[model samples]
Target chain A: EDQVTQSPEALRLQEGESSSLNCSYTVSGLRGLFWYRQDPGKGPEFLFTLYSAGEEKEKERLKATLTKKESFLHITAPKPEDSATYLCAVQSGTSGTYKYIFGTGTRLKVLA
Target chain B: EAGVTQFPSHSVIEKGQTVTLRCDPISGHDNLYWYRRVMGKEIKFLLHFVKESKQDESGMPNNRFLAERTGGTYSTLKVQPAELEDSGVYFCASSQGLTNEQFFGPGTRLTVL
Candidate 1:
């Protein structure tokens, strides 16, 4: 069965602190992996997409790296505005529908 | 460009009632999708539409859920005889093509009592 698991369900960090969130997935024929940031009362905002192992993508203070079995979202010197639920999702090539399997998100709080 | 939009940000209904949610995708996006996230659970796929056709509905939970994308533009999800378990946030997303990253709309939070 295809599944996604995220660790450190919640995290608190003083502003400027750095941390990483983990997303481990088990799927048949991986097609793509995605990262999203969701604010309270709003839908998820797209961040980056990783298509293969050893791939990495970055935007401003965020960097995402992918491996065969897992992915990590590294926040560098995060600000309060960066505090949001970070979500990880995977698309299965075998599914054919291009539907996503999402992990329960990691809630991060960057206190100023 | 305008992002995806959903109607009725929140709704409260009694069990066995009917509720309909609407979504307007970004212009020209050919693929529309429905997803739901129950409290404390991951988001789950409900269905997908390519233009006005139901491309994939294998994720829909049961027959009580009906989704339609009329004219390949906006879409609606109707839940008939809702159950308490139906309470959750319903999200809509769209992309230009199958491989494009989907842009999501602010979800509709449904409450059933």
Candidate 2:
């Protein structure tokens, strides 16, 4: 079965602190891995999509890197506004289906 | 252009009452998807619609949840006789073809009392 697992259920970081959140997955014929950030009382905001192993993407202060079996979302000198729940999802190579299997996100808090 | 949009940003209803949620995907987007995030749980895909066609509905929790995309423009998800476990945030997303990036709307927070 295809599944996604995110570690470090919750993290409290000092402002400007750098840390990484992990997203491990078990899927057959991986198609894509996605990173999303969700704030309280809001839906998820798209961050990045990594298609193949060794692929990487970045936006502002966030970087996402993908490997054969997992992905990492590295926050560089995060600010308090960067505090949000980071989510990970994977789409398999299943034909004709666009559904995404998600992980229980990692809640991040960057205290100022 | 405006991003995806959902109706009823928040709704609190009795367990047995019915509620309808709506979503308007970005214009020209052929792919519209529905998802939900239960309390303390990850966001889950409920269904996907491709231009008024049900491409996938495998993730819908039960029969009480009904989703439809009429005229290939906007969509609606009606939960008849909602249950307590149905409390969650219903989100709508849309994407252009050949791309995996889905833009989301401010979800509908459903609370069943």
Candidate 3:
């Protein structure tokens, strides 16, 4: 069974604080790992895709790193605008179809 | 270019009623997908469409759910005799190709009494 789990279901960070959210997965075949940010009443926005272990991607104050069994989304000096639910999904399967298994997500609040 | 869009941002209906949700993907996108997120749960895929064909319906919960993309354009998801458990946020997404990133819509919130 393929499963994705994210820790720290809810986090409240003071503005300008740095923290990391974790996403762990167990899948049959590893294809890709994705990170998305979702605001209230809006669909998730794509953040980054990590394909292999040791791979890392960054955008402004956000950075994402991947490992064999997990992924980490690090926020540096996060602002209030960065507050949102961060979702993690893993695309993996032997079948030809593209299947993404998602985690429950981490709700982040950056208070000013 | 406009991103994906869904009609009727929200809907409230009684159990056993039918509801149809519509989605219009970005122009030229050949792949469309439907997903849902129940309260306190992660979003789950319901089906996928490639043009007018149903590429994958493995994730569809049951036969009461019918999805169609006539003429290879806009898509619709019809829930016949909807159940209370079916209440959730239904999201639509689209991509140009198989491996490309999918753009999502604002989603439709369905509430059942």
Fnat for each predicted structure, in order: 0.84, 0.74, 0.53
Lowest summed lDDT over 10 consecutive residues: which window, candidate 3 chain B?
Answer: B95-104
DockQ scores for all the models shown? 0.81, 0.74, 0.70
Query: What lDDT tens digits, residue by residue, belong to model 3 across residues A1-112?
Result: 8999998899999999999999999998888999999999999898998999999999999999999999999999999999999999898876558887889999999999
Candidate 2, B19-60: lDDT as tens digits: 999999999999999999998888899999999999999999
Whole-model lDDT, model 1: 0.94
Q: How accurate is candidate 2 locally (lDDT)?
A: 0.92
Candidate 1's TM-score on the B chain: 0.99
What value does the lDDT take at residue A107 in candidate 3? 98
Error of 3 at A46 (Å): 0.7
TM-score of candidate 3 against the unseen true structure: 0.97
Q: What is the lDDT of residue A37 in candidate 3?
A: 94
| iRMSD in angstroms, per model | 1.1, 1.4, 1.1
lDDT, model 1, position B57: 95
Instruction: After the best TM-score superposition of candidate 2, give how far the Cα of residue A67 lies from its true spot, in angstroms.
Output: 0.5
Candidate 2, A9-73: lDDT as tens digits: 99999999999999999998787898999998887898999998899998999999999999999
